[model samples]
Target: MADTGAAIELVGLTKRYPGDRQPSVDGVTLRVDAGETVVFVGPSGCGKSTTLKMINRLIEPSSGSVRINGEDVTGLDPVELRRGIGYAIQSSGLFPHLTVAQNIALVPRMAGWSGRRVRARVTEMLELVGLDPGEFRDRYPRRLSGGQQQRVGVARALAADPPVLLMDEPFGAVDPVTRGHLQDELLRLQRELRKTIVFVTHDVDEAIKLGDRIAVLGERSRIAQFDTPEAILAHPADAFVSGFVGSGAALKRLDLTRLRDLGVPGCPTAHQGEPLPQVRARLRASATDEMLLLDRRGRPVRWLRRADLTHAEGPLTEAGTPVGGTVTRDATLREALEAVLTDSTGRVAVTGPNGVYAGAVRLEGLLGTVRGLLAADRGRAREHQRERESTRPEPTPPEAEGATAGRAEGDAMGSAG
Candidate 1:
């Protein structure tokens, strides 16, 4: 199956139910590029779920356009449209009577794949979702845990290799720890599969962590704001957006990237044969009271303070303070911050998978990265606002041109400054 991600576009999309005073989803226009995972987030009763269902024609729109890869799919038969797109809902949605293999093979079977091909596809998808086909192929749905069942639902959705996937709070039924595990699994699969995904969730942090971009909705399903998580967190579109972001928005954005991605600096280190003056230079140059002492194989010995930098002027040894806690490269900035705060020394030591020292990060470095991200986000928001204002159809009075120019110039200077 050709499963390349397809771009989805919705234009003037509106949905109104019978006897309703207003449409559930107003005229909302948005485009999702190929391979992009867009999260729709808002309060309950918002049109986010309605919007997601419309993509696969689960819920027919009152009037609007739904296009996939530039082809108008709004007119396509609902059943055919849905069969080609993957959909995963809140619960696992597995058939109680069907074994795991049969459940996963349902879609391919519908598509007229041969028995042998269906079996192979089922095995591939089960393994793709991290379930062992040998063990789980014949197990009934009731025999699996909530998380495992959700994985089966996901695998079943992909059995036919659909190009697009729609998920609606698919992890909502599990416990918090299980939900986190499922979320991580989805992230892992997304990296390998790159399916065009429309994910619906009410949690801002989840949206921020999972989405390449997010669409925040308001009353009647209108888009309150649509942008990347960083820009939205740094410069909310209005008071409504700010309030919805809740508290600690900065920390939420900080969680988006791990510590190693920031390229944190390593601590000054001396091997077993380094000169005394060299060790002293490194310690003083670092402006820290202690430095890392290494054994012959380049692992941390102990904290060698400037007071103990002499020590016979030979290779550094075991006479130093105990090292503080270590952090891994994959740890979030929140964890990195914790490590930095709790460390006895000023640095947060980083370790690789082999338990060998990789690098070190200082609190100041983390702060600097946060500041840089915030500044860039604000700048992007301001630039986008200006471009929107510039594109307005209203013509300015001739006399107002001077003021507009001045404002534009001032904005440019402000951006530069």
Candidate 2:
């Protein structure tokens, strides 16, 4: 919100320690656009975390430059530079003696905000992070659960409304389920805040899920590859990057695509008191085995199958099998696919805003989408191979020739979801 999120640039950024044979980060160079989330991922001692800290001056670079929003960071005071960037680390990092409200108010208070404004900010951040302010405010950090403490850490970081956020495996300490929930919360918050985020994680899956562009790091924090997740998935720069992505690349791509990307049709729907004849006609026209029944308010109530209609149901609500659940339009393809698999008729219900019955995504229709996406992804990979070959001055490397026959990797670039 402050003059748009900061755009970060690291040119020849290097850090070395006394008695070290090699620099921890060896002349790393990268650029992060305003309001983008770029994750640095690698194994331990790869310089991923070290490079992340240099952005906010948590660790001073021995040489080179760091810039935020086109201004050099080195000339500025380290404390002031840090104050403008939000930082969250593992295990919440909350002071056990401080109450939740106090923890969140720290930055705002330091920035000389009035007491009234600080309090208002504390309450607002709590709500933004999905915590009940009244119930959690007075409680000390020790009273909160792991997940709750993580939320408070995020709220504290965002309290000052900084233009950049530095996250160091922020969700790493929580249990698997809690970690997943925290990731979802972070993603939702990002959609609203859109801060330039530099997140450091050793987990490839986490990096793929969170980053708009992922910087796959190698020894000494060298950038093995830096590109969009789709590009990386479709075209790994080298064997190291591909090996780092590991197996299940195709399945992982599914989460990146949303249901709306494909115009998946929905089954017919009618209100509870609608005329049976009209509802019957609607169902017959769809040429499907079932239809969705909606409440008077347009929310889904149940599924009306072919057998129920043949029985001449008294009302639309009383007709067809009851709807089990509904998938929102914004849901990912993996979510929609799961719904179809669990659904009795293999016809998943989809909803519009506010749970209104929207359309049905039949299993057959969903499969067609998957086939098309996979095909396109393979095609792109092939094209990338051709381009690389044409641009190379020497003979093609065996790795470049690893294209999948007629298919290219970029096919899954956007539609994999």
The segments of candidate 2 whose C-alpha lies over 4 angstroms from its true place after superposition are 1-3, 260-331, 335-366, 386-417
Model 1 per-residue lDDT at 60: 87
lDDT of 1 by residue, 318-406 (tens): 55765667666655676677778777554667765334577878888887887888787677778988998999899889879999999
Error of 1 at 55 (Å): 1.3
Error of 2 at 235 (Å): 1.5
Question: By TM-score, how accurate is candidate 1?
Answer: 0.69
Q: Model 2: which ten-residue window has the lowest total lDDT?
A: 405-414
User: Which of the numbered candidates is closest to the native, going by highest TM-score?
Assistant: 2
- lDDT agreement of model 2 with the native: 0.85
lDDT of 2 by residue, 246-330 (tens): 8888877876776767775756677888888787788788876677778987888887776787786466555666778667665
